[model samples]
Structure formats: structure tokens, C-alpha cells
Target chain A: MSTGGHKGATAAGRLSVLVGALSVPAFVGLWELIARSRIVNAVLFPPPSTVAVAVLDWIQSGQFFGDLSASLFRVTVGFLIGTAGGIMLGVLTGRFRLVSSLLSPLFHILRPIPPIAFVPIVILWFGLSETGKLFLVVWGVFFTVWLATHIGVQKVDRGLVRAALMLGTPRRQMLSEIILLGALPYIVVGLRTAVSISFYTLVAAELAGAFAGIVYRIEIAQQNMQTGQVMGGLAALGLLSFVADRSFAAIAERAVWWR
Target chain B: MVAMMHNPLRPTPPLRLVDAPPEPSSTAPEAIIRVENLSIVFDVPRGEVIAVDRVSLAVMPGEFVSLVGPSGCGKSTLLNAMAGLERPFEGEVIVAGKPMLAPRPDIGMVFQQPHLFPWKSVRRNIAHGPRALGKSKTEALRIADDLIEMIGLTKFASAYPHTLSGGMQQRVAIARALANQPRELLMDEPFGALDAQTRAVMQDNLLELRDRINATIVFVTHDIDEAILLSDRVLIMSAGPGRILRDLSVGLPRPRSSAILTDPAYLALKRDCLDLIRTEGRKAFEQMEAVT
Candidate 1:
């Protein structure tokens, strides 16, 4: 058994390494073929080397870091405010029939209006500044979170609610214990969706108005015909988005461990 | 009213059983919970559903009574109305001699599921009512600790609901109900979700705890054997739009056990209950089959 286990573990490790090695070679080989065959222009698609060098230069000069930090800050603040408000709204609407009737239709109507549509309006109201960026991010986050909360409330186990009532929970405790606990997994998922939207909306808002942002940098690169730099900036956004998503998922795994 | 008997549980002076009156209602301290011609109708998409018919029942200040019926027979609805969790279309639920309009302070209900708060520890879950109803933090903790010990979950007091087994979660729920020190306890199949071994253990624990607390109890169950073992009198209910069909005294000796189920008299009583319930249960099954 011990020998078999040892062989199995070593085989699994080798298989993972083999897969990783194959992926890199495959990607580079495809890129080389595309560039040499001229199926896509090297100037338009750019070689991976050129894109890597451009990203390295941007990072060394601290411009990429600054833009990344700014974007992160905006999304964080917007996410917190939107999630808090949306959760409050969700609980009230979910718990009370009257409240749901009063607020649900309004939210349903507003939720579908894309944050991009609000770009021009927000910029006009808050000015073409950080305030405008934040407005879009928060709006995107709010709708995602609100929807999750509503669904969460709807799906809570009726039996659990009955049990809490039997266990002598009063009105406020009943809400805090049963309603919020049941809604948590839904809220977490909602927050994750909102976080993704936050980044998407943040990029759009920045590209529309800002002089200093990841999106603005990409736009500048495109205007100057530096396809490599533009591709590098886009790659940076993708990597950052991947990292943010993983962090949220990691925290959520620990937070709602039961689910 | 079967026999006018005071709670033999209290530390009173020695008295003969013969000296006591026979009408149970007369000397039951005061009615801790009283239900008067309670009826309920639920608004469904198709039409109104008559969940309960005119049902009248009363629980003495410290006696234990079990309401037994087939599933969908509205025993749960009766208990819910008594707990002030549901509104009866007609009739009154009087708790501690006061008409219940909403969930009252002196009543606790245990639902079919544990309904424990996963976010909080077992101790904190038990403290929910006391903390909500204005008990100071220290006082609530103290009471919750006592309840945990009483419910035999002292070791799991600090454990979260997710960490505990189903039976343990249910135990936490019982402790939570007891923490408020309610005069009346309303339990709706508190052990239904437990396995057979755990269910029997829970029954013993509950009976032992009930003996100590001396609170008025209105327990609802589908199991006749359980009703016979735990209650002073077992109320057998009929099918849909349910009404009380029989109120038979549980003359089984105190500190009952699973072994009592094998006795001839217990079997006879069980057969009587089954005879009534089987007919009602069959009708309910036929009605359900018709729908589907």
C-alpha cells in the first residue's frame, strides 16, 4: 500500500509538470506560427516577447503600479458602500411583503440599465474625475449585490425559520440569526459578481474620461499605434482581474465553508 | 378535564391522591395555555385551504400534553397558533391567562427543524431570546449556560451549529428554547429529524428535563408510542381540517421507558390509537393520491 501510494503521488506530480511544460511550448509555438504565417500581423497582435518587454517597462517606471492602485482603491470603496446598502435593501425587501412591493419594482427597473449607459450622466453629475469613476463602480456593484440578496432571502429554508421561532428567538434575534445566516452564501456570491462588474465598470469609466488609469494608458498606446503596449496593458488588467477573483474565492471558501 | 391535580413535581407537603378532585382543569394552578375553538384558513393560489377546523384544547400550568395526528392533519397548525406564530382565522389562544395576539414573552416554541443560527456558537444561539428581550449580556450568558447544562449540551455550548451533528443541533435548539424560562413550551416534532437511536435518547433527555422544569408543555408528534410515553394525556387528531378525535389519559407509570412499549396494556393503548389514526391516515393518503 505504501509503495503504491508513493508511486501514485510521484506520477501525479510528474503529470502536472508535464502538462505545465506542454502548455508554455504550445502557446509560444502557436504565437510563432501566427507571426511567421502572417495570419495575423505581428504589428497588430504583437509577439509575446514585445508585449512582455512593454509591460516590464511600464512596471519599472511605476506608471502601471499607480494606475493599478487607483483602480483597486476605487473598486474597494465602491464595493463596500454598494454591498452594505444592497444587503440592507435586500433584507428589508425580502423579509417584509410591503417593503418588497414598494422597492422591488424600482430595483428591477434600475438594475438592467447598464453602468456604461450611466457613464455620460455620472460624468456630467460628478464631473470627469474620480467621483465619476466611483459612481459607475458602485452602481454596477449595487445591482449585482441587490439581486443576490433578493434571491438568497427567497431560498432560505422555511424549516429553519420555524425552528428558530420555536427556540424562543424574539423579533430582532430572529432576524439576525435566521434571515442573515441563511442569506450569507447568496450575499457572498453576489459580492463576487459585483466585484467582477466593479472592475469592468471601472475600466469603462476610466477609458471614457480619465487621463491617468490602466484603461487610459491602453487607449494612449492604441492611439500611438504601439500595439504591443496596448496588449501589455490589457494583459495586466486580465492578470489583476484573475488575482482579485481568486482572493475573493479564497476568502469565501473560508467564510462559507459549510456551503 | 380528567383529573384536578396539582403539579406533583413541586416541593409541596405530602398529600394523598384520593384527596384530590377528579376534574383536571380545576386545580391545575391556572391555565398556562388555553386554546378556544381555534380555526385556520390559508390563502393559496388555487383557493383558500382549510388547514385547521374548530379545535379546542388547553394545557395546564405544568402538565405535559402531546397532540398526535397523521401528517397534514393540522396538529402543527394548532401548535403554531398557540405559539402566536400563526394567526387563527377564528378562536383564541390564551397564554398565561392573556389572549395571545402575537408571540408572547412567556411562551417558547420548538419547530420541526433545529433552526439554529450557523453564524453563532451554541451558547450564543441559546442566548438569542434573552439578549433580544432585554437581558444584560452577563445575565443572558449565565442563563444560557444553565440551559446548556440542563439540555445536556454543556460540552458543545461553544461549538457552532455547522460543527455539530443534527441531534446536537437539535439539542442546542431545545436549550435555546429553555433559556427564556418561558412558562409554556410548544414543541412541534422537535426530534423528527433525528435518527432512531438519537431520537430515543432525545426523548429521555427531554422527559428528564421537563420533569425538572415543570413548564406547561404542548408537544405535537405523529408517533403514538412517543405520545403515550411522554404525555400526561395524548390528544389524537383526525385528518385534514383536523379536529381532536380523542383525549385519552396516558396512565403509563412515570419515568417511562422504551421497555414500557412491550407491555400488554401499552400495546392495547397503542392499538386503540393506531385504529383511529390508521383510518385518518388512509383518507389523507387517498386525498393526496387524488391530487397527484
Candidate 2:
């Protein structure tokens, strides 16, 4: 008998999209209801519409763009460093057992220590400045991407390696072509995860004894009793994260199609 | 045929030649692949196991040779040693009139799995060896295009390995191997993974291809019929400390077919090979059972 199971899949997919489309409005509506009821004090938990207006005012006034740029610039720098180092190290270790043994211990020791855990230490070391923030972001992105790359390289096809050997490919070309191409699916996974880490580390970096960032702006809004401004800043961070994740996901999908 | 007549088959005739009259090259000096008392040993927990025991052979330039034996006969090992992937404990393998100490572009190899890079298109895979061999990028690309067409994959040059069938994939591997224009080709059960029908068809395609190209080929297989069908001469090896049991020349006319498999001469050749292997293989198996 025919399974006819595709009907359930189609219905589930439709429902999933509908739920995603409704999330923002549902969140905004709930906030308004809660504010009117004075459940947590409108000053403490501002209505979503209030936050929306504050966000619009910030963008129109161009105050939001500067903070956004500064945070993004920091993330961009740290992300590049982390990703480059990770890929290089990953490949080196994957190809050579000697490199793997020498470097694996360092990776294990560093991986479990949360990048945010370095915030206080980083402040002491880099003096609560951009350097401190950059350091935090770099550490955060590096280990995650590194782990992904290393695993990817390790997982490459043994048959492909042997084939390359038989076909007269030199060791260098084997690395650049066969091994590198083999690790592409791993790189995609690493890149997608690294983008999330970049965003995550950026927030942590900003919050760690910082000023003039989105996180700092929210903190200031709280102290000033500007409930709407605080809500606006928080929502801005969430939107940025959502957009980045979606974009990375789209790119990953395209890459996998070709890869 | 002058260029390739000194093929590995030249030295290794099958069981029929065990008592044949001695020939001139049987004492002649120069050989392409000179295996002298080559032995290969494997490390086991209890002790050491020897795969090849002081076996020696030679292949001349431009010859089409087949190393045919039952499973675990060390034919592939001998092939690998010649390719310089493995070192013999007791002897040496000289290739192209030089000691083959390591792998090089001069010696091409085809494995059972097509081993085509899944991410790359057929054209890219075919050109891989040439590129790695330091040919100019433009030259490599041109050569790759020519080879893709040669392999009858011109229309499918842009297709990835996953999109191709097993036979097509192996064709790509073969194209890739020959891209470097190697002096000789070492094939380890190249068609062993394909179905019987596909294998038969591929065997013919390969023979046709061989007629066009003059590269010496050392083909390894467990199939007696395939060995007879493809080779100019078949070297049947004995198992359990593999050594050449018989080196017989297949005198059947080329452009052969499945019908040839039933020919009395071919059948007799197969029977002789089976006779040697059947005893050796059974003895090896019984020995293993005794140990267990």
C-alpha cells in the first residue's frame, strides 16, 4: 500500500512557516498586554510599540548606525583572524599526525574555557578598551571554527587520498586540491557556526566594562529609566542576530548544492 | 607492439610455460620492472606472516601483462611494490630501467574504486594528475579536455562523480591516470568492482583502448577468464607465500569475446590455473582453520 506520507510533511512545513511569520507580532502584542496590565511596570518592561518607535527615531536620527558599525567592525576583524587561524591549523593537524599530536592538547585545553569567562581577565589584561573586546571575540570565534575544520579534515575520504597518490598528484597538490576540496563540507559547517560565534562574542565583548556599544546603550537606557530605549536596543541586537543567522544559512545551502 | 612487447606478461607466462623451452630474454639483461627475490611480510600478533616469498619477475616496455591468481595470492602486493607503495623485504623493483624507490608520475595506477573526486567534474578529475605533475595550467586544461573526449565523457565533462554511473566513474579514473602519459599503467582489479556484464564490456573497452595507447600495463585480477581475455600473457601465482606458479601465454587472437571464454584452449588455460589455485587456496584455508 502507498504510504501517502508527503501530505503530513507538506502540512508541517506550512505550519512551521506560519509560526515563524507570526513570532514578532505575537511578541509585540504580548508586551503591550503586559505593559497595560502593569505586571512589571511599563518603565521596566516597555511596550513593543514604544520600543519600535524608539528604534525608528534612533535610525532616523542616525545614532543607531554608528554603534552598529563599531560593533560590526570589531566582530569583522576578530572573525577573520579566528577563521583564518582555525582553517590553517585544522588542515595542518588533519594532514599530519605529528601536527595533530602537538596541537590537539592545546585545542582541548582552550575549548572548554568559555570565551566570556575571559571577559574579566581580558579587562584586566587589555584595560577595558576595544583591544579587550577584540581579544574576547577572537578567542570566541577561533576555537569553534578550529574544531570544525580539524574534524572536517580528519573525516576526508581515505579512498580519495589513495586515488590522489595513484594518479601522480604531488603532496602539495594533494593538500591544496584533494584534501582541501574534501574538507569543503566541513568548512561550510565551520563558517556557519563561526558567524553565530562572532555575533555571540560581539555582545559579550560589548557588555564587558564597555561604553558606546548597543549593549552599553541599553545599559544606559536602563539607568536613565528610558524603558523604550532599552527595549529598542535589545530588539535591535535580536534582529541583527536573526538576520545574520538566516543569511549564513542561505549561503550554506547554496554551498552544499554545489559542494 | 614492438614498444610494448616486453610487458610484464613477457616474463610471466602461465602454468603451460613451466616446462617450455628456455627463451633468449630468459637470460637477456635489460628489463623495465626487475623484481629480484622480492618478499613482503605482514606483522601478526603471534609472529610475522610472509605474503610473497622470494618471488621475482620482469616486465619489458610496452607490454600488456596480467597477474592472475586466487585471492590472497600477493599479486596486488607485487604490483604495489613495483609501483613503490610498498618495499620488499628481500629484493628490489626497478622500473623504466631504474630502481622504483617511490611513486612518481611516470607510473600510473588504477584502483578498483574509480576514486574520482566527488566534488570535481569529470574534466577536472581527468586533469588532476597533469596539473599535479607541474604542467602549465593552460596545457593541463587542454589535455584534460582532450582526455575527457577520449574517454567518451565530453558531453558529461561537467557532471560530478555522484551524477555518473560506476562504469563512467572508472572511465574518468582511467582518463585521469593516463593524463600524465605514464610509461606504464598498474591496474589493481580495475574492473573487479563492476557487475559481470559491465566488467565484460569494460574489459573489451580497455583492450580497445590498449590497442590505441602503447603504455605497458600490469593488470592484477582473481578472474582466470578475465586474465586470459585481457592479457597477452597471464602469470598465475600460488597463494600462502605467493610465488609464480605458472607463466602461460594466451595465444588466442585479440579482439576477443565471451565466446572465447568457452573456447577449448581458453577453458584448458583456466582449468590449469584453477588446478594450481584450488590446491594452494584450500591448503591456506585449512591452515588458517587449524590455527583458529
Pick by TM-score: which candidate is best? Answer: 2
**Tens-place lDDT digits, model 2, residues A1-259:** 2335788877887888899999978987887998989877877777787888888988898878887888778878988888888888888988889999999998999899988888888888998888888888889888888888888888998879877887777778788877877888988888888888888888788877676678877877778988899888988888887898898899888876645
lDDT of 1 by residue, B1-292 (tens): 1121344554654567666532323334456677766788999999998888878777767889999999889999888888888887887776766667677657887877887777778898888788877889999999999888877788887888888898888888877887878888889998988899999998888888888887889999998888988899899999997899999888888888788989898999999999999998898898989989
Summarize candidate 1's per-residue lDDT along A5-76 as a digit string, tens digits.
Answer: 587877888888899889977997788678767788789888888888999999999898888888778888
For candidate 1, the per-residue lDDT at B121 reads: 85
Supply DockQ values for each candidate: 0.28, 0.50
Reference-based lDDT, residue B162, model 2: 89
TM-score of only chain B in every candidate structure = 0.87, 0.88
Model 2: lDDT of residue A252: 84
- Indicate the docking level reached by candidate 2: medium
Each prediction's number of clashing residue pairs: 7, 9
For candidate 2, what is the DockQ? Answer: 0.50
| TM agreement with the true structure for every prediction | 0.87, 0.89
